[model samples]
Target: MAVQDGPHQASPRKEPGCLRGLVALVVFVGIIYAIWWFTGGRDGDDEASSTPSVSASATGDRGGSSGEWKAGDCGGPDPDRAPDGYEAYDCGDPDATFRALKIMDGSILPAAVQCPAGTDVIIEVSMNSGSDVKPSGGIPTDTVCGRNLSGDHPGDAGAGGGQLVKGDCVTADVEEIACDQAGPGDLKVLGLVDAGSARCPSGTTDPIRLTIVVGRPYDTVCGREP
Candidate 1:
């Protein structure tokens, strides 16, 4: 005798929890992006990156000038020597030499030091008077060094490390900041009101003159200007 057919079973539908999980995942990502936007996306917190880029070539001071100012390499023997009427700070580690930038009477002078070829560094410039800098203009070039490191030698004093604002740390590299026109290896031009401008926009030296605290890796040296 033939057996009777059993009742047909219905296929199980997909669980509702799976759909809920997908929705939750999307919501989580949205929340994270919202937080980042509110925080100004990390680097955007400072004026260095936020500051507008302009041509320094107008100064006509092109390359390192002899009469108006003097330039010296940092991280060399006697890195502690401060230029006239200025002070020095130890911005580098024990294994490396420290360099300082001296500003006096609205003029910037370099304190010489010999740093490694690929060392990242930071240079801070502050007017002792907290004055707004009205940049006259100069050649927009890579870090103009006391000794020109162009062509093949790679010892151009131009800027070799990234740019740090006030208190960030860095690890400079030779090829990294070497010939680049901006960022770590880019040339440093004075007269522009970087951070001090917020305090003394009118342009009068109160006490500070561009103090560049070069931490090896320029980016870490200067904290983003909040």
Candidate 2:
């Protein structure tokens, strides 16, 4: 029998390289897609990555104290006993009120209240500086102390009210303070009655006292005396 001529057949071209390249491309694409899915795809909002700081809302039903304090009224170490240097007082909770009473006997004591995180503070200085000397509410912008600061009490007198803040103090020039004030997040200084002229009721110069209402954000200022 005549040798049957094999049907004409062409050798199959090797496409392994192409197949390998395609596999590699798929793997690369899959890896890139996985990375993208894990990274920037979590949050769908178009907003910037940074968030702004915001004031926290007041909680609880406790109303703060409305008056100043005497030296004997405070417990433990007096907040005003700064040793010839700067000392800081952290009054937690905005609803909580703090008072600093310093008995001025020729020694100068400066104290400040600090608000930690999410809180603003403002400080007012009030004191009975003995003499008839009155603290001139000085510059209009510097009236960040005493009464209502939001201009709610327009022309209202004394270390008036202002925005509360954090890390601020009310310095004193005299003995007794009425109601000190502060705003959230702001560190302020309230001017006390000048001890030089403002004398005490006893004829002996009185000490400087400061009352701080923590937690409320105010717009008042404790500016330097003119």
Candidate 3:
């Protein structure tokens, strides 16, 4: 006698619960991004990545001289911000060094240049800045300069580290408002320039060969513009 065939069976049904679990996972990820966007986290990142190529701080403007920067104006790169912002300081202040003479034209920055007459010190800077956060073969990756590190203050000075606004009486030695707000000895901070001391735009002169201590003052040159 021939053997009989076995009974056919239906395929197992798919689990509805498993399908719902996958949908929940996607929803959880969406919520996370929404929170980051609302808390100002997204804006900060955009400024860094989308920030304009680079510009020397002439006046108060980001790029292109706005006349905010003057011959006697001084300040250093802001260590606190990414693509560091510049701040202004009183003349002869220790924290303030670089003085704006005038804007020069050229893709290649001059190694040394004279400042306008009557100006004393020069804080020359250069760096190859593009979209890269890190300086490449000739680009600069960082631009922080000053007495202490970011988030730190020289408590001995009495004044904390911050951007000095115009009219704030500051010390000529840069003890930073440690003394009285007024006196013949003190000068008022005009505006801030937080762009220097970092990497320069492409074609910037080499700091070593061109001179200038990155962000520190350049005492040798005077009375000419780059």
Which is the leading candidate under lDDT?
3
The true-structure Cα RMSD of candidate 2 reads 27.8
Question: What is the model-wide C-alpha lDDT for candidate 3?
Answer: 0.33
What are the Cα lDDT values of the candidates? 0.28, 0.26, 0.33
lDDT tens digits, residue span 1-226, model 2: 3334468754456467656877897899877754553233434222111111111111111223323322212111123332111112223423223222222111011122222222112222222344221122111111011121122431122233222222223233211111244333222334223333543233222233333422212213333221
- Per-candidate TM equals 0.17, 0.16, 0.21
Question: What's the true lDDT of residue 58 in model 3?
Answer: 18
Angstrom error at residue 49, model 3 = 33
RMSD values, in order shown: 22.2, 27.8, 21.4
Task: Highest TM-score: give the candidate number.
Answer: 3
Candidate 1 Cα outliers beyond 4 Å, as residue runs: 1-70, 73-96, 100-119, 128-226
List the candidate 2 regions with Cα displacement exceeding 4 Å: 1-11, 42-226
Compared with the true structure, model 2 gives a TM-score of 0.16
lDDT (10s digit) by residue, model 3, range 1-226: 4444489653446446645766786699767654543222434221001111132321233233432343334565544532434555654666554544444322222211322322222222223353322211223222222232233432222232222222233443332353344455554433222334333333322211122222212311111101
User: If both were scored by lDDT, which would come out higher, candidate 1 or candidate 2?
Assistant: 1
Tell me how many clashing residue pairs each candidate has: 74, 61, 14
